[model samples]
Target: MAVDSYDFWLFDLDGTLVDAEWSYTRDVFDRVGDRLGRPFSDREAEVLWHGLGGARDDQLREWNIPPTEFWPVFHAEEDPQLRAEATYLHDDAAELIRSLHARDRPVGLVTHCQAFLTGPVLEHLDIRDWFDTVVCCTEELGWKPDPAPVRHAIRELGVEGEGTGVLAGDGANDVGAAWNAGLDSIHVERHDPAFRGQCVLGDYRITTFRDLGQ
Candidate 1:
């Protein structure tokens, strides 16, 4: 596949570009758990972290805690750490972005994460300039697996022609969004078989951005 042929490339933020090593939910969960006298175990934290799935509010609900009560404490202590840790981007992410830019291919970012979370990572990496557009979860635009956000991004970037755009992401929702929008999709996975039964759905499945060339 010649990446240069694509007029626009859309990317997913969490797990695709940045590894979620220092998740805010994990920090808040642990802190809140300790404070509430219900500390989470390593196993429990792992499950809760994955279940959070980029939505902070969902995690709070799972714990049966009110955001008004919990978030202030979390904001004071854990939010800063989350911001600091998000500073690290994936090893190949910057290189991939640079390569696409060098090819004169316009890059856009589509993330389920809110602007508050996405903004700092883009700023910290100093690669915000590389993206031509960023479509995040706002009041008007809903989450991924819903084609509306993806379509909005494609329309916003003004990319036309069949297969002229690609949506690159790591989850099933990402694949579904691309297919729904009538665009080619490249699935970037950390390990194989996470979407094994559904492998036939994606146009391409790769472990790294480097594989896009092949």
Candidate 2:
């Protein structure tokens, strides 16, 4: 089905709708590396930054890095303002979200990006009001692929049992969350699936919103 076929819509933020500049991503990783006493190669930075390799913890473990040790430093090194300044919204994402909001459709955001960072990016992009509800995944609420956060956003949108809903994102975990929550999904591939080492399946898959046949 087309994007317009969904009664309600959910979105992922970083890499899906908005993304930070490469320089910003590089800087964050550089600082994280310094703190950990180990430097990350450009490829490692890219993979971790975009979650291109799938489960972040699993990826870290493969690199012999302890996730428990890596995450805190990683998050600590991110400067919200600088990251926001470096962030840009995808043009097709802009078109789709604005169109949905303009139509008063129930649109929500369910992202792994924490509240501190998510707030600044949305504000910087001036698109905060577009979503009827925004759900930032937390340790307590659980992360994507678990269905808790997606279900939380669905509850907040008050669209439960109203009609069909769908979540669109750029990661496998996003698709997993959608299916786990009993919602349709769209995988917007922002990078080469080869880089991720697997093709992320969804109810629909496209590289851009235009490909959704909206």
Candidate 3:
């Protein structure tokens, strides 16, 4: 049997590649609040973070944090420092990227992370050269589980045909993104110790990218 049905690979940055611990942003949020003259407790920071990848408007309204000021404050004071902190990568990730590169396969990075943040993280990890393209999409292009960024990666990679691509990552958003883009998904949930079963949303599930068969 064929190991994988793809010549083009779309990857998610945070959990799937480097362990950005994307879900944790309390420290940064706290800093943002401090800079704005409002101190955020851990509780308030958690509420703001859910807004980061989720409903911005609702978060703004509920927290009374102004949308116009929140991001700028966050980016200027918190993002760079957090980017440095999130630079660690999984052990087998680079091996998989290299294996694909050896075969001359095309790879694209589709991340919901900000360009400034993602750019430095990729550079710091030294694996940025492996990907053919990188789309650091934010609210403008839509986030994962919404399908917009997946489609954006697909279009930018310019790979021929539908089945030629597969997106591999650690979260449901990756699987959902692939499904939304009419491609397959491989869930690499090894790093997620809390995860204990197969993902129906994922076309395939593996402990690591090395398990992707030839």
Candidate 4:
């Protein structure tokens, strides 16, 4: 099906819609390491970045870093401005959003990214205005792979039928969420062993929206 095939579109942020380099992953973990004196390894950072581990606290458990202690320092390393600057969107992403607008289809963003980061990144990318709803973890929608968030976004878009909507994301959770909600999924693969596609497979795999075909 083409990009315009669906009446309602639920998207994932971070890797799907935006090219969030998260250019600060290394720097953030480095700072976290300095404070904890545990030091983050490059491979460890990649694992974290890939969403391989459930949560940072869980991932740090092996390293013996206390969640209570590590969270504060890790969160502190989040540089909103730096993140805003580092995150960008694929050229075709903009075209996809505009095409959806022109088609008068309702689009909502359901992301694991909390609001503090999601808001600025969306604004910086200049595409927030295009979405009908943005459900992030910071809110009550819950995180991806659970399906509640995707289901919520579908409802927010007021979609009534099963095949009317589809979730397009780059993570296994994204695929799981769609499966839970009984909706289709499109996997936009950009990187391997990445939150971008890791074990989660999609109903449709496309490197870019154009792969949807005319």
Q: What's the TM for model 4?
A: 0.85
True-vs-predicted CA distance for residue 97, candidate 4, Å = 1.7
Clashing pairs counted in every model: 0, 0, 0, 0
Per-residue accuracy of model 4 over 163-186 as CA lDDT, tens digit each: 577888876778778888888899
**Clash count in backbone of candidate 4:** 0
Tell me the spans in candidate 2 whose CA falls farther than 4 Å from its real position: none
Compose the digit string of candidate 3's lDDT tens values, residues 26-89.
Answer: 6676667678888877645643443322344455767787877877787776465556566688
Predicted structure 2: lDDT: 0.91
Best-fitting candidate, scored by TM-score:
2
* Candidate 1 accuracy as lDDT: 0.70
What 10-residue stretch in candidate 4 is worst by lDDT?
191-200
lDDT of candidate 2 over 1-214, digit per residue (tens): 6656889999999999998899999999989999999999998999988888888989999999999999899889988999899999999999998778776789999999999999999998899988889999988999889999999999999988889999999999999999999999999999888777788889889999878665
Question: Deviation in angstroms for 20 in model 4?
Answer: 3.3
1-214 in candidate 1: lDDT tens per residue?
7677577799887778875664655776678677766776664565443322324456667767675766555445455436646556777777788888787787888887667667777777777887888999555887666788888887777775535788988776787788887878988876445423234257888888888772
Root-mean-square deviation per candidate: 4.4, 0.9, 4.4, 2.8
